[model samples]
Target: MGALETMMPPPKRARLNGVEIGYYEAGPREGVPIVLSHGFPELAFSWRHQIKALGDAGRWVIAPDQRGYGLSGKPGKVPDYDIDHLTGDMAALLDHLGVEKAVFCGHDWGGLVVWQMPLIHPGRVAGVIGLNTPFMPRGPSDPIAGMRARFGPDMYIVWFQNPDEPEAVLGADTTWTMDFFMRKPAAAPADPPPSASGSTFAFRDLLKMWDPSSDARERLLSPDELAVFADAFRDGGFFGPVSWYRNFTRNWERSATLPGRIDGIPCLMITAELDAVLPPSAAEHMPAFIGDLETKLVKGSGHWTQQEKPDEVNRLMLDWLDRRFPK
Candidate 1:
């Protein structure tokens, strides 16, 4: 733990756009609004440290659990979870807060949402900040086609987009899935590799490979921290979060309607160096889509940069926000 961790207060929930979005807010109510969006398989608690740090800087920060994760309203229908619904839910949250425009920040899938927000509702965004994920320009063909071309047969996207299969594969073992996503990297392989693409292991087994030493494991997340995540997932299940991957084609079709360049919006992108899923290479051509962009690479971090390195993440975000909206 660090200074940022000590200052974090528990989160509160609110009913926004028919969904009870679990959110954490800090600083004065009348301060400049900064909306923080969480990624898949995560909650607004992911921004716990950020909420405290940025709030102390005299900025109003609101981190929402979005529609489908945590205590938020998790609708049953697949169509209800589309990109339009996701982005619209966010816009409605802003409306509920009586905010005309706010600094929008996102991570992972949330990054994808914020990237499209300026294009979809240019009027609602004052500035943009993306963590881990980046913008990829869509061409004449489908977006997944390019990803498939790059990653080949074993790609997670292919499995995730299958609709029926992932709900079973992922949902069957929610604990393992959560551990696989949160586990840190390892120095060596513990056992011989499995033959098949889907040969599975227990979540704890996979985590052990990351670091055999119990002390190292303890440092990453205490039992209490792990319990916090487990309780949320155990209660919510994995269907809603996994459904995010199933929306790729829908997003592409909707995004196809937007123009090539979106001007006048200030953008900031922070790349996680160790992010295996959305590598830094994906961001190579981002400038082609965004008009004014500022990018940074957060070294020694992975997909969960905000949780992994809160201080560095907060410093970059606060500096960028201050520069965009000076005192």
Candidate 2:
């Protein structure tokens, strides 16, 4: 029906990690396997461009709708969405596909999963590549506590810990929510630093604080492309998606035993130059945590780096793969 629909198509379901995962697969069955993971409020559909590019270039690409998005199974409890369970979904997907190990690429929340997978399940990961989000090591405190101390109660992530409230607010108008988040952020407002006020600005107020006129939603997606996300969110609702944030503390506690550093894995971190939520500066401390990390800055791109600059992201991924996991 649309270019994305034609290129990426619908997903086939696979039972992995005790949940039914909706995934799209392409390329030769024997080709080098690569798993592409999408971020919050996103589906495998977000990876349409990379799926086609990698598939055509002779890769067995598998893009799953993760645990609680798209056509996948939606677990009820917030604890179910913790990092261990999230990484298990990917590990189980490989087992279901008869793959011992595969190159894993993730964006946003997906990036968080890939970064932790190498630390938790080393043997199952061949390499890790992150888009926008970087590998952040856990500090002495629980992540949610740290976030609360840094961003206060109104922060989108902090607000999400309440569960039902956020789900209701976000699901009330899925279309607007989708359009609002998918749009480019407005200029960085002059705000108090985290240390200055004991809490940085609240991103939960983005929809209300930023000017609607500045949003690039109309330019980024056609009604058809937007519908793909809006429709799925409408059906699945935001409960499962928001549940991901609710597990910040659980993930931190579970990962306490993991070594403070992630080594032995070839890692790539791509920074979206204009991404307000996770800017290029976020990766400054990455080298300390990731031993073999390689970094790239996607010029003129925002949070949706792969979707906004598909060719550049794809070329960078392909070249990195050729060098690290060569044929």
The C-alpha RMSD of each candidate to the native structure, in angstroms, is 4.3, 2.8
Q: Candidate 1, which segments miss by more than 4 Å at Cα?
A: 1-11, 145-154, 186-219
Ten residues in sequence with the least summed lDDT for candidate 2: 188-197
**Pairs in clash, predicted candidate 2:** none
Q: All candidates' TM-scores?
A: 0.85, 0.92
Clashing pairs in 1: none
TM-score of 1: 0.85
Off by over 4 Å in 2: 2-4, 185-204, 208-218
User: What are the per-residue Cα lDDT tens digits for candidate 2 across 209-269?
Assistant: 5455755443566678788888899999888888988888888888778978888879899
lDDT of each: 0.74, 0.83
